[model samples]
Target: MAKIIEAFVDERGHLHTSPASAIVADIAAILGRVGDEGGLTSGVAALILEKRDAIEKAFADYDMLKSSGATIIDVSDRLRFQSHAE
Candidate 1:
């Protein structure tokens, strides 16, 4: 988790990574390069492409929310309940 945090931000607390949209575009590029090899059959590749399309929509929604200056709301389970679930 610490490594992930460090990857996006430097010691001075500045962004050291590309925008989320750029990362999502990279994901799309990788999906486009998928081939029927390494157990990735044509059918599996089709499914990946379909899923990537849906994921792009989600990313666009987040981008809109951020651009609108809206606060991003997320849900977190209570620690007591989380411990029990674990």
Candidate 2:
């Protein structure tokens, strides 16, 4: 009669050891390479490129609103803001 040999295992029942930090580092490296290779161009990117000027204008408008301490209005027709008080 042969004796059965049993190996101690953890809850996962796997011998592979992997840390979370290693996985994150690998993902970061892959993303860095992808970014260097011109990034992932999707429909959203195309739309942004098409309306880049409008986006820049929108950001500038928001910054102006913050600096001038103006009141913002979001109407169905358009966005209107009052100038800062003197």
Which of the numbered candidates is closest to the native, going by highest TM-score?
A: 2
Which digits, one per residue and each the tens of the lDDT, describe model 1 over residues 5-30?
A: 53454233445454443344444445
Model-by-model lDDT, in order?
0.55, 0.51
Please give each candidate's TM-score.
0.33, 0.35
In model 1, residue pairs whose N, Cα or C atoms come closer than 3 Å (at least 3 residues apart or on different chains), thus clashing, are none
Clash pairs (backbone) in predicted model 2: none
Ten-residue region with minimum lDDT total, candidate 2: 77-86
Return the lDDT, model 2, position 79. Answer: 25
Off by over 4 Å in 2: 1-41, 72-86
lDDT of 2 by residue, 12-80 (tens): 443223443333333334444434353543333445555769999999999999889775666742422
